[model samples]
Target: MAKRRALISVSDKTGIVDFARELAGLGVEIISTGGTASLLEREGIPVIGISDVTGFPEILDGRVKTLHPAVHSGLLAIRDNEEHRRTMEELGLGYIDFVIVNLYPFQQTIAKPDVGYEEAVENIDIGGPTMLRSAAKNHAFVTVVVDAADYAGVLQEIKEGGDTTLETRKRLAAKVFRHTAAYDALIGDYLSQQAGEQLPERFTVTYEKIQDLRYGENPHQRAAFYRKPLAGKGDLTTAEQLHGKELSYNNINDANAALAIVKEFDEPAVVAVKHMNPCGVGIGTTVAEAYRKAYESDPTSIFGGIVAANRTVDAETAGMLSELFLEIVLAPDFTPEALGILTRKKNIRLLKLGDWSRAAERKPEWLVTSVAGGMLVQESDVLSVEASELKVVTDRQPTEEELKQLLFGWKVVKHVKSNAIVLAKDNMTIGVGAGQMNRVGAARIAVEQAGDKARGAVLASDAFFPMGDTVELAAKAGITAIIQPGGSIRDEESIAAANANGIAMVFTGVRHFKH
Candidate 1:
């Protein structure tokens, strides 16, 4: 077997010294760069600096160090190619069998509230990713290690087998590419955000495998779990759960939508979500009343749905909730009797999201999706619109009672699928239209559900109207005022429709489309 040569250069020297020492013990040569070499020298382990082997000093503000052909040609040159061997021999470039690197903390730097734009820009690494891609590209001959957490496992495998197996090498290389991809995305996003560009028109993200789920959306499909950014942040992932079944894909999605809506209310609130859309919502004097009103709002759609509540669940509320067939129920807390009552449903998911109002934890966790041959990532939909943030835009201002219902309608609308319409009054949703193919169809469903009560109720929309039809429907249904994101090209038509009917309208400057 050929002797293994590992090149280790990391901005984060978390476990570099120990890792280098372990490589030395395994008879592997350690080649590193800049601080890594200095650190290993201090640790009394022999580490060759890139300059020593490449015979070129690190110049151009340390940017010219690893960019040399000496490093990359060594990493990329095919080991089995006779012509490649001749070229390497002529230039005297050694093959790199392993590459260990981690990029600068650009994500962490930008996340700091006080960090300046210049500081965030400088934290973007150049040479680290170059070496990582080179090693990762030649996975057949090289093992790329970007995570310090993988160091111990790599060392164990090398010590046992005298070298990393090809399977391990490929897996490690896949991780290296993922690491560098995520690093570049964070930098790209930071620069674009700082420049106030139009969200870069497109966003890309890469994530690491954080876990493997029991199964994907279904047991038939294999699945794994990954985490995006927020490595050191105490996000919702860190929250405590009281009990329930292992969350399924649909359960998590609908639970998040339910939680977002429920958190919008300061008073006791209950929201039920089905197919990632809010099917029922209610706010009341007590948690029990809230749940009961929410269930009554659309009991037909609430079956097998995920439920979220703003207030701690009491025994009375739990008893009422347990009577139904819910997939999940989440609240800030559960009274002893409530937990006892709820735990009887072994397959139900229960979550505890305490005191989100305080934001005592870090920034919210993000949700990411994978598309064909690519992926998409975005911050969790956690923006809470306080009553103070609302802008009453109509000539006829909403009454204090109407404003309260407007906010409640706003929360429920945010959790519904796009083209949504919610008719709500008296702190309970009277009717909701979710996932309709067209906005007018959604309005019809909402009005139909509200029936005669539609007259005097408030309405909210996930997106603005393309025309005046939805506004006319809401006005005909007796909606007091309508709330929407309000950036439509036909804004005047919708506004005129609302004004013509003597209905009030407000602009929230935010759109909530669950789909």
Candidate 2:
């Protein structure tokens, strides 16, 4: 029988020397290239260089080494075909039974803060990916390994038997294609950004799986958590879970919503989110007070919600949190006492997100959503209207206190699902109506939730009221002032309604529609 041959080439030399040595001991001829050959030779493992195999020296700074027919024909030729076997013997070409390769660190190089374009471009491996693709394409005969983590398993299988099984080869081939695809995607995305293309002609993103959840939003569904390659600081995807069981899909979703809302405030703030909608939001003198106010805003709705705080959690706040049946609690930091108190509830997931305050200033580059058969991509909704940008379109102007509450309500309403209405007083959201089908329906819900509190509070609508009915509802509920984006054609009718009911209304000239 002909001697089995294996080609090994890698930028990451982890476990390569030992793997090659084991293969050599098993009567397998080892062929390698460049740094891999040097490392193997130093470790007392005999290696046949690419130059020896192809009878041609590496040219173009080693870029043209593995592109030769000698290398690819060995990896791609069919073993079952008599003609191919005859041709291989005629050309003195040997069959490559295995190919172990890993691409250069292009993603890692580009991640550096001071990486130059030339350095990044040079790191994109051409020959390595070509060899891998060739080997993977013929995986019915050849075994290919891309990840260093698979080295031990491949060697173990080879030791147990003379060669790997077809099942193992097929699985390894699938991984190789996925690895190369991600490599190509990284290169394309980086170059597009370097060329100042905000929205690429083709939108492509790669993510690494963080964890597989027990189930999705429901038990019958499957779900996993994936994060972008270069996630920025203060991103929820990068948050550390300090204690408790693994996070469920719903917990992560609601925690993200709560975190986004809490990040909007610079002061000590707490936000409770249920089903991706803010059930309560409050800013207070201390983190404990903020949690108390937020919890009291709608205690029933916040029963099983996720809570996020912009400030570091103290013992007092943790004590208050322990009283509730919450899913998750996220904060920038937690005092030793706070952690001790919260950990008592073993099922509650505690996440300590360092420097979460910075999230308010960090804008995501893109927002992606999945639909029936495709994806929708757009710039993130990072725009927020300042207090100075508010236009008093009503006959009566909002009082200074009313303006403060209106701004607070505006911030909270932006995070609520549409059609959304938020009623706030003293920088605390007393009521929030989210995901209603109509503006009037949302307004009525908020008014009913606030009850007597709506009399002196301000109302913030995510979008303009379609008609005066919503304005009339708020007026009847005794809401003192109203703030909205105000782009509807019937803005005059709503303004007249506010004026007639002695309610001051301000138009922000900006809309925040969250679906």
Candidate 3:
């Protein structure tokens, strides 16, 4: 039998030298290209240059090196076929038993600050993917390796026997295809961004696995956490877990909701989230005051909820937080005394933010939700409304104090699920009704929750009131001011109800519908 031959070409040189050395010791001839060949020869590992095997010098700046029939036929030739052997003899092609390759650093190149288009374009590997696919397609007869972590396993198998097992080759080939697909997707997404295309013909995104959760939303379901390859600073994935048990699926989801709500306020803020909905939100001069107000918003719902604070946690705030049975507490930082107090609870998760300002300022370009067959993608809702942009639509205009409360309520209501109603007073949410089927039902729930607190509080609706019943309900609850998008055809009825009840109403002209 002819001596076995292996081709080794890679952009990531991790563990390649040792693997190649072992292959040479096992009597497998090593063929390499470009920098990989030079590095191996320098490391005292015997190497046969790819040009020496193909009899063709690498041309076009090394882009056209491995695109020849010599490389493909060597990788693709059927070992057990007589016709394939005859063709290989006719064309002087040698059978390649192993193909080791990893693609160029396109992802790292694009992630650099102010990277030029030419540099990014140059990093896209052409011959690498072609060689990988050809070798992987013949995995029944060829062994392919794309990840450096798999190098040890392949080497061990080769040491035990003469070549890798068929099962190992099949698994490695699947990994190679997945790696190449993700690489191409990243390049596609970068090019689409450069072309300023909002929605491309074929949209693709890639994420790297962060962890495998114990379970999903339920105990029986399976789940894993993944983050974008190029996540920005201060994202939820950037949070450092200082204490507590492994994060559950619900914990991460609820904590993310709380973080999104806390970022809406410039002042010291606290948001308590339960089951992906905000139970209470408060902004105050100090974090302690914010936590107190948030706790007072809904003491019952905040028992096992996740709390996110915009400012650092001091001893005083930590003392108050320790009084409750909370699931998670997230803040920009924590004092030593505060950590000492919170660490006593073994089940509570403590996460420190990377950068508070960056978290507040950064906005996601797209929000995706997966459905049964496909996903729905839309631009993230980052709208900020000022007092000057509001149009008073009632005879009794809102006073200055009412305007501040109205704007605060508007920001809080935007994060709530659709059919949402928020009653806020003094920059604190007094009552919140989310995900109701009808606007009036949502309003009634908020009013009932607030009770006497609803008298002077301002009401903010996610969408325009379809009828005057919601206005009447608010009037009965003594809601002083109302803020809504005001695009309903029955706008006159609502305005009349507001005017007759001496309630102030304003139209933002922008609806915030979060479903």
Tens digit per residue, CA lDDT, model 3, 399-515:
999999999999899999989999999889999999999999999999999999999999999999999999999999999999999999999999999999999999999999988
Off by over 4 Å in 1: 1-3, 12-18, 38-44, 56-64, 82-93, 156-161, 199-202, 208-227, 230-242, 266-268, 285-289, 311-323, 332-345, 354-403, 437-515
Best by lDDT: 3
Candidate scoring better on TM-score of 1 and 3: 3
User: Which sections of candidate 3 miss by over 4 Å?
Assistant: 356-364
Candidate 2: Cα lDDT at 481: 96
**On residues 196-248, what C-alpha lDDT tens digit does candidate 1 reach at each position?**
76445676655566556788778897777555564442223544667876766
How would you order the candidates by lDDT, starting with the best?
Answer: 3, 2, 1
List per-candidate RMSD values in Å. Answer: 5.4, 1.8, 1.8
Report the CA-based lDDT of candidate 2 relative to the real structure.
Answer: 0.91
Q: Relative to the unseen true structure, what is the C-alpha lDDT of residue 76 in candidate 3, on a scale of 0 to 100?
A: 91
Name the lDDT value of residue 27 in candidate 1. Answer: 79
Q: For candidate 2, give the lDDT of residue 289.
A: 91
Tell me the TM-score of each prediction against the true structure: 0.75, 0.95, 0.96
